[model samples]
Target: MTPEEAVTTRASRRSPRPRADAARNRDRIVAAARDVFVEHGTEAPLDEIAKRAGIGNATLYRHFADRRSLLRAVVLLIMCRVADHAERAAAETVDSLTALRRFVHDAVDERVGAVCGLLIDGGGQDSAEVAVQCRRVEATCETLMDRARHAGQIRADIGLRDLVISMSQLARPLPGIEYRDADAHRHLDLLLDGLRVPAPAACGAPGGAEERSVTYTEHAA
Candidate 1:
């Protein structure tokens, strides 16, 4: 089974293990919901998701029962993927900055910000599994930030929230500024470059990058 399938099963752990075909259908539905929700918010028609999954409306209803259950599954799906990316990035590299950038860029491809912003006020956010996934993301981000800060790669004043908020906003699509056409990675390069303090020359003073926010920790808090 795919990692996503594993997460989908875990999200519905209370339910009996579905038959192989039914499990495959559930996985496809949740994966489709993730993409459809990103493209058309949580209020998007159930037909759209069903069509995207190449399934009928009845099948979708059989698996999800209602929109709220589907929404919860989709949220858990994205959150679990986000946490997975963070963990994989850390495991694949010991370079803290590189790992952090990898995680952020992978998250951008997932279009987490758009889905999350739309569902921010939704009841799905209250899911116990959602909170667990969120905590995993936060913990990984914190570890990466601390390592990067100690190595003088990222700014000392920048907290974990700065990195979190940056990833979210960069992935969010704006009017006439869809993510696929924009230089989102380039913009991330700019923001990340801004976060670094320049190394000192052999006999000169170290220079600081232009900061965008000096109070994000408190402001976000």
Candidate 2:
């Protein structure tokens, strides 16, 4: 091939390369930001995320304009995953109570706790994008709560706001507290009992009697 033709061919090949690299860099930044933020909360430094991503700060800023921008991106990414989980839960479970229980169980993990902690710490002083993501999460939770209530899996008296608040509280990981999966399951079982209708009658015995019980115990943290 001629020199000029070779040069032209190389240039054409290189032209799309930077765009691909940029795309990859953006993905790396997002992934790294997610890991860092989840580990250190949203207050994690962008420089740390850049370093973890193996990219320069300038590149990170070029992709995400500011901390808030990066935070919003992370929040949206998490919310999208939550939405997918909700969809899957809805489809797979026949019982709304089971679905709600599964959803809460899935959310009580470290990753969800980190996200919830970040938002709670941020409080009312959040960026517009964060606010939007919050609203989306709220809306999704409301829909799930409504479905659960409609299916008689939740109390009619409990509002979506109350459920949302309860979810946030339950998502918190208490320090010095040894929480086991069985404890979580027990908590969920108690919550479900509170939503249950009157117990059904016993059968197959003449002296059968229903026993109503409510017990509360405190555990050390």
Candidate 3:
């Protein structure tokens, strides 16, 4: 064989075709980890994650060197996805308040908040990439919230911390009960009602049924 042809053949041998099965396995692992983390928090057993993915411990180790690594990957994945959704929500609608409401509703519906809730309780070491991803998500949320506030849709007393804490708290599952996105959404709708300005009462409306907007006092930071 010619020298150039021989070199090309060697390179091809070194770089075999992509392993479709391996790729599928990695995907399954990521998905399973996400679910396990949401259900059991980040401290969930790695072996359980493997079993859920239909893979062995050795395979799980091959893909993720340690639990911290796996947790970071899950955090990064969920953050990026939620950020993408936030970006799309921010741009898709002309009404800033509508966009914010839509984003929050959809986020709760998808249980994105629950993922973050687990991470907060996990207390795992966060890699720089994971931290950066987290900042990105926070910034996106800030933008959405600010826009809504500027549009007079959100109360002046609300802040990013309030939103995050509410999300995490609402996302958490009660003892002996599993987390349900529907339950979260229901509470979120009630919370949103509190955030919005109340409609003005009609002239000569019945007493005691008048809408009252919650008075929010901003505390010193």
Candidate 4:
């Protein structure tokens, strides 16, 4: 090879990645920030985040120059994860309604609803990248909804907004009530059941509330 090509190849090889430990610390900080935000809202102290991450304030500041920057990282991280889950649910699950159902359950368990509520109240999309990730997640959700709707699996009345509001409501922890994942899931199932289109009235019979109350799994069958 020519000397020029050799120098180019060496330069490419010399391009550096972050040190492994530094990268790991940043990830840990992002994760801890997410949990702390969920528990204490976006305005929680940066020191709390550093404490949760088991890192020094200096280290946290080294990774993120300020609270807004750190919050931005947390927001991007959550949205990215949500986007991945949505994409996976769409591609890997054969049955559209089942896929949607699985995605909703997984999202709820992820505390996505809670995180969103917190963000809405105090924080928001801090960067253009966050907005892009938000749209990506929404688009995947829309695709899932459209597929289920087209298949007559979910009700035509419900749309993405309805589903999101339902998720947000279910994700909230009401005052004076103990929070349990099981309870959240059970309520979510109810909402999902409400979103399913009831079977057509048999031979012009009335479509009653009882019919509408059937489990989504049974209706899917």
Per-residue CA lDDT of candidate 4, range 1-221, in tens? Answer: 99999998999889867889999999999999988987777778999999999999999999988777777777788778888888988996477877887778777766777557545643455578888888988999999999999999988888898998888788877767888876776676666766777744431232233443333344335
Q: Which ten residues in a row have the lowest lDDT in candidate 1?
A: 200-209
TM-scores of the models, in the order given:
0.78, 0.60, 0.75, 0.79
Clashing pairs in 4: none
TM-score of candidate 2 relative to the true fold: 0.60
Superposed model 4: Cα runs more than 4 Å off: 1-16, 115-118, 121-126, 199-221
Tens-digit per-residue lDDT, 1-221, candidate 1 = 99999998888986766789988989999989888877777789999999999899999999989888888888788878989988887786456776776677677766678656646647366788888988998898788778888888888999877877887787765767555623665565556666666532221212322342222222124
Model 3 TM-score relative to the real fold: 0.75
Looking at candidate 3, what is the lDDT of residue 41? 73
Q: Write the per-residue lDDT of candidate 3 for residues 1-221, one digit (tens) a residue.
A: 99999999999999998599988888889889988987877778999999999999999999888876777677667766777778887787567765665667656544566565556654234567667767777888899889878878878789988887787677676769765665665565556666765424331233212232221111001
Candidate 2 structure quality by residue, lDDT tens digits, 1-221: 99999999999987755578898999899778877986666778889999999999999999988776676666656655665666666666456665665565555442454566555554223566556655665666667777877876567887766655565555554756776645654554455455544422432223222231221121111
3 against 4, candidate with superior lDDT: 4
User: After TM-score superposition, what is the CA distance of residue 195 in candidate 2 from its true location, in Å?
Assistant: 4.4
Best by the lDDT measure: 4
In angstroms, the error of model 2 at 137 is 3.9
Ranking the candidates on TM-score from highest down gives 4, 1, 3, 2
Prediction 4 global C-alpha lDDT = 0.77
Q: What is the lDDT of residue 31 in candidate 1?
A: 89
lDDT of 4 at 107: 79
